[model samples]
Target: MLHPILPLILFAFVATATPGIATTLSTASGAQFGFRRSVPLMIGSAAGLATVTGAAAAGLAGLLLAMPSLQLAMKIAGSLYLLWLALKIGRAGPPNLDVTMAKPNSFFGGAGIQWMNPKGWAMGLGAAASFAALADGPGQLALLLGSTFGLTAAVSLSLWCVAGMVLARLLKTEWQWRALNIVLALVLAASIIPMWRTV
Candidate 1:
């Protein structure tokens, strides 16, 4: 049973670390506002993922699966939100050299993204489903899964933010910042492919 969970932990790490809307936004925030300002968003993302994990362990995924229409509605709503985020990222201006002037991604925005993120739902549900039988009770299973997800999400988001900070130094000019923002926005938009397939 422990052995099975080891693999799941690894999967969680990879899934969280991979570039997604959350990571992209974290990176963007870090580039624009630096690490300190991005902490709230990172914490919010972890909290949001923890909530998803808890929901999955409590059988919310099963409920969603049973109601195909509801699931479809959620997917559509999530996709639209992602597109809107992409648009915002695309239009974002160059980073303000003065930290005081920088407008970073907010805690609520980060949490809201995870709440409506289809990938987050899939990952949480998949993890819970894969590990359900290993635990003795729903509560125990939820605690384990939620802790694992929250830890991984926090670490992964921080790494992405650090990477963005590094990249921020390289983007010395407005054009470079604008170009990178566009690329990140495109990546965010492309992330909708998985959700579209489910639709």
Candidate 2:
């Protein structure tokens, strides 16, 4: 039997290193909202990653995959949500002056992106399935897989956000920030293709 913990470790490191829509959005969040404001988005992303990983480990993702109509539902919901977010971000008038006092963008921005991100689903499901296949025992494996993936996602995504924050200084203007957000939103919207194709 495979060393039970190795798969979790591999999943954590690999998932964190792989750039996904959440990474892009987190980077954008850090740039636009600063590291503090980006917290909500990051948290959201981590939650989404955990949810998917848990679902997969528990066999829910496989069931969802087997059900054609359910898969279609998820695709449609995710695609439309992305489109809505794109429109909202594009129309955002200006950054509030009291941004520092405002709530972090980590919650919705981070989490919402993960829910709509097909790549996230793929990673979570793939990792969980591989772990399940390798495991010799069944006790609490799902919990272990979920926790490992979730913690890794949070840490990994935070790094991306911080990198974005560090790079924000290079932008040097409000227009650049706005333009970046628009572009990121558009990218997020465009990422729905793989999910659509699968459906």
Candidate 3:
């Protein structure tokens, strides 16, 4: 079956291009650890989002949506985790913000976060609902969603990471670095509001 590949690519691009929890994490990791060390974060983010989108395509999202209590619990848990991350990121410095800190936001961290990310859920559910029908079967739909979103996410997040790396070079002072961290943390924390309001 011809899988509307072009339209799927376009849709995936738009969804992944928008800044969200994953992008924010990518940018933060890049700024803190530089592009090379942060590669895992970007890759894991792409993979995690792909998994989420694929699972949603496989009917997990629908099951969650039908369970109001479970969904609310997930939202609360996700919000708390994001807030904790924001607090930690907000407290940045010179020596303290080294590549060693990368452990917290390594590949596993990036992938784990997406499971609780509202933006990931939004995009995954949206894509599953919008594009799943075009697929020939559940397995094919999951594969299509995963592959398309994964590739687009990789590119989009790499750009975000690069942007953060560039911005880091411009920072001459500790205060400037701290300020950027604070701003990123705030934006990441703030990302929850819009999605929370809808729920």
Local accuracy of candidate 3 as per-residue lDDT tens digits, 1-199: 4556778899899888887787888888777877888888888888998998888888788777788787777778888888888887788664355432444477877787777765676677788778766788888899989989999999999999999888888887889888898899999998877657644
Between candidates 1 and 3, the lDDT winner: 1
- Which digits, one per residue and each the tens of the lDDT, describe model 1 over residues 66-181? 88888777778888877887787777767764333246767877887777765677777788778888679888888888888989999999999999899999888888888888
TM-score of 2: 0.79
**lDDT at 169 for candidate 2?**
73
lDDT for each candidate structure: 0.81, 0.68, 0.80
Better of 2 and 3 by lDDT: 3
| Order of the predicted models by TM-score, top scorer first | 3, 1, 2
Question: What is candidate 3's CA lDDT for residue 180?
Answer: 91
Candidate 1 residue-pair clash tally: 0
Q: In candidate 1, residue 149 scores what lDDT?
A: 92
lDDT of 1 at 4: 68
Superposed Cα deviation of residue 194, candidate 2 (Å):
2.7
Q: What is the lDDT of candidate 1?
A: 0.81
Clashing pairs in 1: none
- Which lDDT tens digits does candidate 2 get at residues 1-199? 3475775787676776566566766776676578777777777878877777766677676776788787677777778876766665554423553243244454755666666555566666777666775555433556767778778888888898888777777766667767766786787677677667653
